[model samples]
Target: MLLGYRASEQYNSYYKPVYYRLAESGGQERLRELLSQTPSIQIYDTIESQLSELAKINNPQRQLTPEEYKVEVARYLDGKDPDEYGVWVYYPWSQKLVHLLDEEEFVQVRTSRNLYKIKPEELETLKTKKLGIIGLSVGQSIAMTIATERICGELYLADFDTVELCNMNRLSNCNVYNLGASKAVITAQKIAELDPFLKVTCFTDGITADNIDTFLGTGSSQLNILIEECDSIDVKILSRVKARAKGIPVVMDTNDRGMLDVERFDLEPERPLFHGNLNEEGIDLTKLKDLTSQEKLPMLDAMVNLSALSDRMKYSLSEMGKTINTWPQLASSVVLGGAMVTDTCRRILLSETTSSGRYYIDFKELIK
Candidate 1:
């Protein structure tokens, strides 16, 4: 009964949020009418909490008594209609209505905790940037972390696969309920719930040679950076090829021992893809698509530095197609990879770190 679901209405279509400004003419009447007709409506209001936080920001010198707080609130409103203040957001998927400050105020109070860590100017700059993420399994962590940080204004998510029981192990955002849903859709919905103001575009069919140009952007609105995490050997290499052509930086985390790759294609236009790992193995990029699964192992090995991998990983690789059905990944590593990639991408966007190389953040080596 949620949102009067029909067989024809796809779940992906409900990820967007509807907004109503009570200050606008007839806004309250429209919302009241809808609520009256709807059998189930969950309303939440947190505007007062937001106002208290705003008051603190303005009057950091001293605390306010309850009476003084009311005065401060009145001063802040300045005779504006209380019901008309802020914006009302309705989520169709959950049938939940939430009231909160508008985009500018919401962002300021929501991200106030990150003040010294992320300067105001830097956050403003980041809000104007766009990032594209491929392969939503481990990429989920990266995308969520970026969203929590309010790092970018828009996100482009691409993944051709759907959620499966096996993916729940490392994909924290996925659960049994989403087993049959598209990975990109799940991620987009989670992001919308977290911050409806942020923009999210889903590539349900995932990225391919056909749409790579549009994914990387062909016009003035190209992606600022590309996060490559797809499983396909072809896409892993192909994305970098297209990214390099557009002078967009690319970052990847192998989700093993914190192996991170940063390719500053924007800076080094001619840098070898994957730090030339394939070239070292004498593998030809042109013939990569022709290689069988078994034949592609060498390239994959080179891409992740197989010899340097932990003993358990090497053992897992040997057991693939035998003991285990596919490459093994742990929740801890995948989450760490998300954090690692998020931080790397943030720095890349802010120009804090500029280099092209493969680095390892092996826990065993660092913790000990």
Candidate 2:
């Protein structure tokens, strides 16, 4: 016969069970065994116990609830010294915590917090706004920033490219495991993991001229912001034109030494200066499309001449290929630029004016 009994320790209330087994031979032996088993049952107390019983009682580790975490974040943001409360150890990035320990580095954190405090309305506005981001290289940074801020109810991610090894340097939410996955698909999966309720629409093929109308003009297109980070300058311009035409403000962040060229084409007709110049009266997109590469060069030269753009500029354009490569200089620039873009977008959404224009931040000057 075998029996088990559940038992708990009086000190900690931790539960475990004790087991007993009995064996039988002959009838007389079995009766003797049964009688002896009760008395001879070696109560081998096989119970496990923690070595540091006092520590276990005093400091039991438990995860902070979401609300508790949010409250902590808010308090930290409000300039409360987290280290004094001993809660700063839990959050490594807490500026208040860092400041309390290192007074020399405290000023920078305080300044950053001051800037962040200026956009209180942005936090609320982003929760209800919708944004469409094309190209996942630099766009991933933008998406992550937006998601971190808890803004933007829905996000539409579009990219035709797959996660190549070269993209690892700049693209967030990309890993070796996602190397061959479509950028849009991987980004959507990552965003879903971050916030299950975030409405995400992924287009693996990306937005083309033919599908651009459907993407931005459909009944589902309620986007408040359109971010253009495509590899192709032509596509970037085209996407901006389309978004502007649809009355959605277009924001583009270029990695020109961590500088941002923000154009708010929130015009009634949503016309952008680039489109206005490119789509001039005599321009023929269809004719240019039909021409071969060899034939297109001469036509492009003629068009450049007709458009009155300088020969030097035209030569520079010819020398610069279409694909925007991510150099270390540009990668660093894009990150800084993305942060500025996020701040600017927040200001715009909140209807606050914090000076808007094509702002450039020279790293050399910044370092100096």
Candidate 3:
């Protein structure tokens, strides 16, 4: 019911450190180790073998028409081994060959129900758009959401930080096994396993002034949308400056009170960066670093009207590393943020009625 994964897949989708049995490191070694313990490994001779079993289930009466059988048989007669044609990935604990579905077919099947609502034309428009996500804490959920929904052609993921124990509170993908792994690398690997064809570019060192151009696709096609989520206020401002200069739209989710921001530099080339929050020409963004809770508060106030935020958020900000080392974010807010950003991105890229603005999914307001 949830993106083709059942509740049983919860651990695999969110909790476990994602592992595969293929070309990735430790892949062959892990497979050999597991296979040594088990008596046999499972494999379907071809995709046709699996299809035949399904056909039997679909028609135990054996009443399939001659035309149906011919069409079905012709489906497999493309002169290539069905299992061999596509990339293969084995999820942890799976006991058989897991041939990834064809890229186009996978997208179509996974997002089939999202049609008409998202609109077929809108989905098509999203197909070729390039998206970028910086910082993989909240960004990780956003990346996974975008991947599952097949919203963009390529996803540029930027995150320099490695997993830390504190990160586990909100990063559903974090686990003890990958405690110190690079966030960008781990995310890229997960995306590849999810949709082999979902193009991914990782910026393990995170975006900087020198590399911002490359991350924004300067030498190549510019990104259609940027989902900025980095901790460094410097990169945050710098990225938008580049985005504004290049005429690319930007998106950001604060993961507090379900806050999401949209800046349409593509629509209005001269639009001020961050809606004038960084308008002071003298402000040296390069001097900025990952802000402490107190340092972030005043900057946040300028970016957002703090009065509009929930009481809980206002209370948390007052503590500033005393009661809280940083901002408090919940899984619910992070998940909601991912959906909000992607939906906003879709609306913008499709040239819909959606305009550049800020919106919220305030739980306090909603619950009341």
- Which candidate achieves the best TM-score against the true structure? 1
Each prediction's whole-model lDDT (CA): 0.86, 0.53, 0.72
Per-residue error (Å), model 2, residue 69: 12
Counting only residues 3 or more apart in sequence or on different chains, how many pairs clash (N, Cα, C under 3 Å) in candidate 2? 3
RMSD value for candidate 2: 18.3
Query: Which is the leading candidate under lDDT?
Result: 1
Better of 2 and 3 by TM-score: 3
Q: Lowest-lDDT window of 10 residues in candidate 3?
A: 10-19
Candidate 2 accuracy as lDDT = 0.53
TM-score of 3: 0.77
TM-scores across all candidates? 0.93, 0.56, 0.77
Runs of candidate 2 with Cα error greater than 4 angstroms are 1-122, 218-220, 268-271, 275-279, 285-330, 354-356
Candidate with better TM-score, 1 vs 2: 1
Off by over 4 Å in 3: 1-74, 78-97, 290-297
Whole-model lDDT for model 3 versus the true structure? Answer: 0.72
Task: Mark the 10 consecutive residues where model 1 has the least summed lDDT.
Answer: 5-14
